[model samples]
Target chain A: NAGVTQTPKFRILKIGQSMTLQCTQDMNHNYMYWYRQDPGMGLKLIYYSVGAGITDKGEVPNGYNVSRSTTEDFPLRLELAAPSQTSVYFCASSTGVGETQYFGPGTRLLVL
Target chain B: AQSVTQPDIHITVSEGASLELRCNYSYGATPYLFWYVQSPGQGLQLLLKYFSGDTLVQGIKGFEAEFKRSQSSFNLRKPSVHWSDAAEYFCAVGAWSPDKVIFGPGTSLSVIP
Candidate 1:
């Protein structure tokens, strides 16, 4: 079973470019999350969803939006990417509260 | 509000030597703590966590973490360092229920042969 799968393993976007990073999990987990990792910054939560159609803002949700159309899919949208938004994005899911989150391979994004 | 602090920005250890990474958290209530390791170009992998039960928790890859309630710290330790263990380690904390997890500035581990 594929735990979590992310698309567009790597991408480069110019200023004002918009794109979506797709994340899907086959674990049928109830909790899904989006995070970005930067040098020495560890991982900061971008957005999260408890279940389908129920998304919530997280610690660093200023420049992105997310949608949870299905239990297996959670996609992040960057309307106008900026240089600061360039970071490795990760998707994760957990079976339930206080559970270990399984992470996807990650998508490397660079905004020019 | 909840926060995590990884005091060590970077650490260097000789192979076969013991290693420890410090992590401190500040939360109003009981905190759920976690340690995740990230290799080059890879996503974060769970090493260990602390929620309840025993204070000491053993995790994969010969790593372990001890939860100290009084100190509000959950420190990760390895008996011996391995070359493959060189990576960035993150400490995180959150509420007992699912929500946003606060992450500290990660500690990068370098193992010398």
Candidate 2:
């Protein structure tokens, strides 16, 4: 299985710009999550979905949005990028919450 | 509230030496603990996990962890360290069914030859 995959491995965005980070998982996991990791800091949850058509806010949800249109896809949208949004974004999915979350290669975004 | 802590920000060990990375967590009940390794510029990879039963769980890459409920700790240990083992290690804890995990700040492991 391919596990989890994320697109746009690296990107640069100006303040107020917008973009979407694509995430897809070959495993039919019901739960998907988005997290951002800052330098010398732990990963912070941005958003998550238990299944298709279900989404919820997480620890750091500001300046971000997420949609779970299908069991395999959960994309994170940066709708007004800010300097704070510049960090490594990771997409993970699991069979259920608090299970072993398989992570994709992170996306590094720089907001200037 | 659930949280994880890797008290040591960085650890250095000579090749072939034993290594231990500390991890402590805060939660109300029995927690699902995990250890993950992240290579530079990559995503987090699961090293091992603890749900119940065996407190000491063996993971990939000769990594093992001991979960101590009294101390609220789940420390990762490797008997012999290799240069390739240099990476950031993260500790996380939470349980299933209306629970979410929180990760530690991460401990960067450096192996000297």
Candidate 3:
């Protein structure tokens, strides 16, 4: 069912460049989340959505934005890419809060 | 705020040997704990979770974890290690929401034949 899917598995961006990371889930989950994982560190939440048209900031939401236009899609936007933003970004979804979240393959971003 | 700690950064065990990975968490109220495994170049997969009741929870790939409330620890164990079990294991604590979950730094497991 393609539990969760992300686009451009690997990407490179220059300083100040902007991009959008696309994520889609077929699980019909009501919750979606964005997280960034740095080397030697655990994942940090960037943003999340409770349902379509409802989004909220997470632990590390700075320099990032998200939108949940449909139940199946949640996209993360980077307004101005910076070196610190270079990390692997993962998208996940769950049926509800506290449910087992299914993750996508992840998008590796490198800012030069 | 909830947090998790994985004491071991890396561990090595011979094939068919017993194995254990330690995890500790801090939270104000009853904790919802989980263990996930990640293989190289792959996404994280749920191994097991603990909500309430049973202190011992079974997971996939012949793995199990014991939750000790007194010590605030949830340790993963395997009776017999396999080469395929070599991966990074993460312990996390959270409430009912996924965004509230906090992950540990992760422990790397290596199996030698």
Which runs of model 1 end up more than 4 angstroms from their true locations?
A: none
DockQ values of all predictions: 0.75, 0.73, 0.76
lDDT (10s digit) by residue, model 2, range B29-85 = 988889999998889999999889989999999999999999999999999999999
Candidate 1 structure quality by residue, lDDT tens digits, B34-90:
999989887889998888899999999999999999999999999999999999999
lDDT of 1 by residue, A1-112 (tens): 9889999999999999999999999999989999998877878888999999999988789989999989999999999999999999999999887789999999999999
Instruction: Name the weakest run of 10 consecutive residues (lDDT summed) in model 1 chain B.
Output: B94-103
- Alpha-carbon shift of residue B44 in model 1 (angstroms): 0.9
Off by over 4 Å in 2: B97-99
> Which residue pairs in model 1 clash with each other?
none
DockQ leader: 3
lDDT of each: 0.91, 0.92, 0.93
Error of 2 at B6 (Å): 0.8
TM-score of each: 0.96, 0.97, 0.98
| Tens-digit lDDT track of model 3 for A32-100 | 999999877899999999999999988999999999999999999999999999999999998888878
Candidate 2 C-alpha error for residue B61, in Å: 0.9
